[model samples]
Target: MTLTQHWKEIVNLVTQGQRSSMHCAIASVGDDGVPNITPVGTVFLRDDHTAYFFDSYTSQFAKNVKSNPNVCLMAVNTKRSFWFSSFLKGKFSSAPGVRLYGTVGELREATEEEKSAVHQRIKPLSWTKGSKLLWSDFTQVRDISLTDFRPVQYPKMMEHLWN
Candidate 1:
């Protein structure tokens, strides 16, 4: 489906996934042609059909993207309440997961505005000891130009959910 048309839903799903799981898996091809997956928690989507993530603490991911820009990001809703309700209803009300396919752009220093926004996004965790350690020192970001979107599907469980 077109990203422009589904951007809102995609954003909502990603937000929910973030709340439930705290991170998304980004898959990229390594220099040896093997697939590598990294869990990134600082990803954020802009109004445009693009997403950005902090590049700190991801040396392998950065290297992989340099060699091959193509990547896939997957987010899953892992909240216990969501799963319990879905199980009780015998189907999921919404998609359980989503996959975004895109090409990652070169890493660059984050602007002051971008840094501020990132701080605001994680402000709730400011009191935690690990917050500073984990969120600080992020200087670079890689822009992902989303080109495709796919919903994770369970055929048997979803057969009657939509109707």
Candidate 2:
């Protein structure tokens, strides 16, 4: 389906996924035609069918994207409660996850608004060591123009959710 058709729900699921799993998987193709999956936690989706991610330590992912700009990003709600309840009830109130297909833009310097968004997102872990190690520095970003999406469906459970 077109990402625009389900943009809001897609955003909600992706945000929940990041919160539960701490990251989403972004797939890109290397020059050798091998696929690489990068788990990134700095992805931020906007109201439009666009998103940007902090390119702080993504050397490998960056190289892959440079070679081939096309990318697939999969975001899933991985919360135990979400899974347990859905499986137990044999139904899902909404989609459990979504995969977004887009093209990565050239890595560019982040704007003040972008920087503030990152800081705010990670403010809860401000004093933590891991946060300092991973999120303390983010100056560059890569934007993605989302075009398509695939819903994660569990045979019977999610059959009606998206209908």
Candidate 3:
């Protein structure tokens, strides 16, 4: 299918799911030009076309994006666990006028509105020993202009992978 059509399907899947958490991965060139992938949890979307994330000032993902400006995103719905997967990739940038990719950059500071939302949705989990904890007000937002997309009609085996 065309990119636009594929994007529509992806969006529908995400919107219909019970849980919609943003998946972010940044690729950094190693000493030998190989790429390293890091999974991060501080990601969000601003409306249907814009996306955002929160991270510490010293996060590797934020650092990598500032230096490289290349990033990838995946949104999955696992609650259903039948068959589903979606992903996105583009240059990681700031909302107003900051270009961050593979270097040190500031995370978007949360606004009062966002703070209100967090208070409503976030629940306090029990803390345990040996847990790596971090707190930051950094927010990262991006405007994604969907330029290309593709859809695959996978077999049952592959369908399980998507789910």
Top-scoring candidate (TM-score): 2
- Backbone collision tally, model 1: 0
Superposed by TM-score, candidate 1 places the C-alpha of residue 159 at a distance from the truth, in angstroms, of 4.1
lDDT of 3 by residue, 1-163 (tens): 3433334445554433314343344345544445666554444443344444444442554445555554444444433223322222121111111112322234556776655544343334214331224433334433333333332333432343222
lDDT tens readout by residue for model 2, 38-153 = 99988999988899999877778899988799999998998999989988898987788889999999989999999999999899998999999988889999999988888888
In model 1, the runs with Cα more than 4 Å from the true position are: 159-163
Give me candidate 1's TM-score against the actual structure. Answer: 0.92
Between candidates 2 and 3, which one is better according to TM-score? 2
TM-score for all models, in order of appearance: 0.92, 0.96, 0.50
Q: When superposed on Cα atoms, how far off is each prediction in RMSD?
A: 1.8, 1.0, 9.9
lDDT of 2: 0.89
lDDT string, candidate 1, 1-163, tens digits: 5778778878988988988999999999998998989999888998888999988877788889887999999999999999899999888888888899999999899988889878887899977889988886778888999999887789777765323
lDDT of model 2 at position 37: 91
Top-lDDT structure, candidate number: 2
